[model samples]
Target: MKYLLVREDDEGEDELWGRCANVEGLFVDPVPPPREVLTFRGCTPAGPLREAVSRPGESTALLGNGYVEASDDTQVDWWELVDAVVLAHHPSRSDPSLVDVVVGAGVKGAGGGGFRRSGPSRFELFVGNNVSAGQSLRVDGLLAPRQDPAKIPMELIGCEPTGRLLSALRRPRKREGDWAELWALDRTGQVMAHPAVGLGIDGTRPSVLGGTLIDITLTDGGDDRPAPAARPVWEAWYQGVPTVPNQWAPYSSQGRSAWLRLALHARRPRRPDRSGGVHHLDGRFVTDVPGLHCAMSEALAGPGGYFGWGWDAFRDCLCGGFGLTPPFTLIWHDADIARQAPADAVSACEGLLSYAEEIVQVLEDVGVTVVLA
Candidate 1:
């Protein structure tokens, strides 16, 4: 495999920065959530706080005092205002794990005590104890590194020192907003992964092969890549290898997801919707989420056409310009293959209903008459 470094110039054109004989630190883990400290005030305990204090290691949500003015929004869950889990409670010294600092205590019925703007609280929180949606997404992990928080570290081995790279190294220090993209390519020069990165130059030295070795750190801006195991699948696709139906069925859930992601990224631009006609989706191989996507893409726009990668993306496709507008008829031949098959792990976690069932409903909802045969 070879690596290429590229950058987008002011005109938004991709300029090749240089090519590397070898590159390291492309694969990475997702960035962890930022640590936060929250403090609550007052004194008293409606429910025994001992349960939380007893199990310091276990995570538990801290509830609101129920005294604040309720929001007019009907969707609000007032009962559980702070949804994050508590990592450590510091009031009691029973557990030695907690940091020695009492910020606030969970006071039970501090009569008429609304959300205080300022005052000494007896509780302090850290890390997982703050408001957050959830952990970093799995896709993020494949795009960047997990060092110094959310930065990617890379060492370019035997780099063909370009004027651009050499000039950057000669600078006294890196300027703000130094950025580039690292692309991985196969032996046949097919691009595999390309991720936008914020570059931090470490140093540069001469290589044994007369090339320069440059070490740098990178922060992921975003990327088009997949897990290592799934690269072969994409490579084959790039080589125009015939895809046997259900070819993706045997891959692991993560692999299937990677395959689908790469397919979505690699899909051809949406062609104008047909004026009028029926489209037939070959559903014989629709045994998994990725397969469903592959079959659907080919069905709508011919070979290698992309309709959507998932329900949301599919809905977007149905809105228009994806080779087929709404109100079209779709004959899903051998649809039972999808109906009877268990969903891949990626789809199963999305919802209880099978993805096939959801796909049909989405189509029908948008006026696409689905003939499940």
Candidate 2:
């Protein structure tokens, strides 16, 4: 038996129906024919065609706008007609041990009339834990006989990952705001369409991945790049006295200044009623970009009054060897103002946040507690 899959166009042309009727094969046309040619309306021939295609009976030739013609000796299998790649894997909502694999590709609808004239489509399938991103596979199994052919469910039979698929996954690329193109490739290395994938970190590096520093810079401004500077010397206090209890604290002598007050609230000391050790850092600062930089530099100034104003400088100070001591808490007041800064300034602020996250991760790795509020 043979099957023909014809897609409907916007103009409502039904020429393919005539071709299917004249040919001595089973026809699976989704678009309704003219009323004079066929009285059936909202009726589709998907059920019979799906049964004919999947049952282990006789050889078949699957013909369609997107389908390739099967050879004489080759048995027609639904899986052989479609190609897909694993986009991501998550624990199945129904079962934990089994993973819910998200696969995507450009597949023609099988029987249902719900096929869209789009390139690549995404669907989820349940698979074993062995399945992972970058793995390519073929679709096999039966489609449910329904009006919406697009809802056709199929099983993914694993196949070796193609070199192109692996290469694309290892260095995924986003084109024209689409990440789907990274995985929607045919066996012959042809890309179907650009699709989106949530695979990369959201900010410029240095990034904190699993508590380790990723030494990659993502900002175009080069703010996180290492710069040549004098060897950092550590200092604990200034003029043999802790700086005033203002926002600038003991680092005020270093030319570090903030527009807000920095007050250290003492808690009950370890010994009953003496005094509580300073427990947490809490404060706010100007939300503007330039103000933010100045406030941060002043708040984190080191012993010699040295405070770097940019991400590179801040990172150096956080890694010790500079003047600022570890186990400190920083309370950033009015931090939300940065969001309204100019576009370029907003980008710089994001880079600063990235650097801060990385620094916090590194400090935590060494058991040094640093809190940013």
Candidate 3:
């Protein structure tokens, strides 16, 4: 089985580790990430990486067998090895072979990006409302009267949760025209996601999936042990985590950050419950998002012809509810779901649809039309 598959748009694979990997990092695999899933693998293990084919300087990721080579190592020399074995990261400003750079692009399953034509979406983004809903659906040659959407990449900037490391990762080396980070290549010889951390612990290698993880820890840096939030160790798994923070939680501006994304997601039930892992969450996940019924593009086409009843069927939500994720795009061992771990986050448009409904219903039940997005 091919462990790594390139996601439709992302330069990296849609990793299945958890919200960070599945949603944020984009680990490619057979299945898509689920809404309320059980994360199986924590960090990628080594053993399998060293056995794979490799390139000149690129090595493995600190996480596991997934390969980790910088996709844009176009310098004239062998700097990748120096950076990989020394600094541990090499950032790529633009994702390679990007065909569609769009936002607010999509058609169905609740709401997220508008589904239409594709464009150069450099991710000038907002979690939900920094701009308008269906924010200017920019695509192949569809320019508006007063706007140049072409500047979306430069004009609207979204923050990656890892902004703190950008400088160090993108730094220029003493060698002119050389990148600050190392470039990794896969068995098929492709540039993979930059691991960012864990280079040179003991001669790292690359994985067929793109990169392998080195067993290293940088969280303990800066004299005193940094807080848990700064570390690379996966967040601790526990039962009863809330679907949203308890109102007073501090939020990071980089909404896509793993920790922040999990907050808005559904809470997974603990062990010993009858629901059988997350299957018990069936009925609870669905709810209505404000203006959900009104939010569709006038051109929705009505579920292929059901009309009033067809539109109404969406309101019923027979499938998974809003916020609740579906079966994972990738599952680690067929058996042993526990090893897969509980899902605490979501990103799929389908899963987000479940959430959109849930939010709408929550407001409607209170007799308050809180929002229409």
Candidate 4:
């Protein structure tokens, strides 16, 4: 309910659009960005397909879809499912293409099942090196990751009739390129998440509830609501804005994960790295993977600040602009908490290493001096 929509002024400062009294589609279910899913339907297996799938790291290269093969152009909409893992390949169902013949994971149903495509297509799956199978493939009409949302309906209350909102609606063509950040706040005036959105011409109407109703386009519509288990953490944050360290230590693992996610979502643009400072990290609460990330994020940036949620994002943060630059000393207080907490394995070239070791290795690799205090 506490939402603030703000766009940049000519002077490059965020100009608030007053308070948003009522908003729809702002706190809706979070739809993750769509990934490329290789869906093969109805096609029978060939050349020891089951045996090839049983083997580890069995990759399958889909040459081209029916859409590509029917066309005259040389460009094929090709996709390869690397380390391809078969989710379901049962040929015993009544309808051959009703709801079966799932393929690959991660991008499409990691645990439950693989992604399914609608319609029909003729494609060949080259599995391993010797085995090959014919597949009826079709790419679904799901929105791609880079595609913008069609619309995000919102209503602003207490806005001036001759204000920027009215002005933008009057001449949408001239201001069509404008974008704004919609910042949602908690009950205690703490920011929840700020998603960037663009203005639109259509569906801009005066609300019957004495406000302006506008349909904005989402640049990125991240999930606004916290998890049920993590609601207490948000409530705790509402009790007091996290200014010091260890504020996230008292929450459960699930709550901590949600907290880290919220921190990641609420990340603002960072100033240029001054490039020198000893970032002291309290490791007493590094009981889980999420806790480790939460501590690291809060340590590097501030309370509710984010460095990274995972190793890749961590490396990205170290590149610059995430609070402290590398080459500075990271005096990790109570480092043994992480080292002796648990044996979490991380993928490495030689073999698997504990997550703690991986963290230290990543830090050292990035030119940050790590001190185990």
lDDT of each: 0.53, 0.28, 0.21, 0.57
Off by more than 4 A, model 4 = 8-18, 21-25, 32-102, 106-162, 167-179, 185-193, 198-241, 250-280, 319-323, 326-351, 369-373
Per residue, candidate 3 scores C-alpha lDDT tens digits across 1-373 of: 1111121114543322100111111111112112111111111112221211122364332111111111112211100001111112122124322212211121112222222324322111112211111111122222212221110000001212133223323444211221112222223333322222121111112322243321111111111111234222112111223223111122221211222223212222222311112111111211222112212211121111110112234443323333222221211112222212223221112123333434335334533233221
Candidate with top TM-score is 1
lDDT of 1 by residue, 293-368 (tens): 8788777766545677765687888888666787788899998888788632223312244667777887888778
- Arrange candidates, best TM-score first: 1, 4, 2, 3
RMSD of each: 11.6, 28.5, 24.3, 10.3
How do all models score by TM-score? 0.59, 0.22, 0.19, 0.51
Residue 25 displacement in candidate 1 (angstroms): 3.3
List of clashing residue pairs for candidate 4: none
What overall lDDT, based on C-alpha atoms, would model 2 receive against the true structure?
Answer: 0.28
Alpha carbon lDDT at 247, candidate 1: 55
Model 2 TM-score? 0.22
Q: What is the C-alpha local distance difference test score of candidate 3?
A: 0.21
The CA root-mean-square deviation of candidate 4, after full C-alpha superposition on the true structure, stands at: 10.3
lDDT of 4: 0.57
